[model samples]
Target chain A: ANDDCSKMLLNRCSGCIAVRKSLNSRNISKLLHSCPHRCDHHKIIVEAEDKYKSEVRKSFICNKKILLTPRRRQLRIES
Target chain B: MFRGQRGWFCGSVGQDLRQLWVAEGGTVCDVQAADFLFSCDASHPDTLRIYQSLDYIEDNATVFHAYYLYAVANAEMKTSVALGHFILPPASVQKEIRRKVGGFIWEQDKYFQIEKHDEL
Candidate 1:
């Protein structure tokens, strides 16, 4: 939604995209430690973790200045 | 057969696939002088000495996989672009050019065109 904070926002700062990796790892660990009597929660945890990671990666790339640099092969010729 | 003093054999296919084809040689001459060209079958060796010489020439020459056929001589001269060579599949395999797999089809060429471009 438009309400989502843009990482590269010039005036209103949200957070650094690079820090999401550690944030995600911390989240998964917290979820695992809080699980008391495990039932079908394993599948739910795995699905949630995958979704979180995908979102983190997508936003990280989007908020950055650029992704991949453009390049072409050099042509060498002789007479 | 090529008769010009400055000659070049080029493989027009992609660099990744050019290695599979044999080299060709020949000669070209025209009153335009600049239009004069020569070519030979570089892939077919005339003699042991000539075969080695052709290989040495091709190895030393710069190869280009241009949209159109391109030629360069001695590494320092200007490169020339031309459409002299023609590569195509043979008539026998024309029917088998493309085959149906599970849900996909594949095409293969039977004939290869190998030609040399003369100095411009």
Candidate 2:
């Protein structure tokens, strides 16, 4: 029984990670509401959401097009 | 099961996990020579592309995402996969590690506990 419980826990962990990956880029709200797992693992979902938001912010800040727009305008004015 | 295994740690959190892996009797090596690739940021384009490319992944190598371990530490969930792959540790061992680690990525007690709600 102990072994069985352990296996179950392992499977749950595996499933949770799979769910997290699947929902990686999707809406965090969807993960909270529509996730099939229906498991009480909101903490994981929240962390994923936080990570996603930070990544998006980082990418936006690093985007070359956005960063170069002012430089390009300056070059045009100089020309 | 990790004994004698050659593992590679990628990303910031990878270093901590690498330390733990070494403590577990695992050897640290280069990515190409590793049996286990522990990646923290699987969402990165290069990491994602490499994971998506079946040919890039070695036949015998297993990729474990750091998020999975973090989840496990938080008692959230578990796995190994294209994105979700994980190395399974026995529940008792996992619990012990969790207790020792006390929050994998972030500091313990920093995360606010939300009330359990069936509806989100």
Per-residue accuracy of model 2 over A1-79 as CA lDDT, tens digit each? 3453344345443334444323321122333344466433333433343344345445546664234233212211211
What TM-score does the first chain of candidate 1 have? 0.32
Per-residue lDDT of candidate 2, residues B5-78 (tens digit): 66566553444555556665768766555555666454544344434332221122334554443443344332
lDDT of 1 at B47: 17
lDDT: worst 10-residue window of model 2 chain B: B111-120
* CA RMSD (A), model 1: 25.6
Q: Give the lDDT of residue A38 in candidate 2.
A: 41
Give the TM-score of chain A, superposed on the true chain A, for all candidates in the order listed.
Answer: 0.32, 0.31
Docking class of 1: incorrect
List where candidate 1 sits over 4 angstroms from the true fold: A1-39, A65-79, B1-120
Give per-residue CA lDDT, model 1, range B1-120, as digits (tens).
Answer: 112322222322243222221121322222112111111222322211222222112221111122212232211322221221111111222223222111000111111233443323
**What local lDDT score does residue A28 receive in model 1, on the 0 to 100 scale?**
27
Candidate 1: tens digits of C-alpha lDDT, residues A26-75: 13233333545332323332334334334444654677733423323223
Instruction: List where candidate 2 sits over 4 angstroms from the true fold.
Output: A1-79, B52-62, B67-120
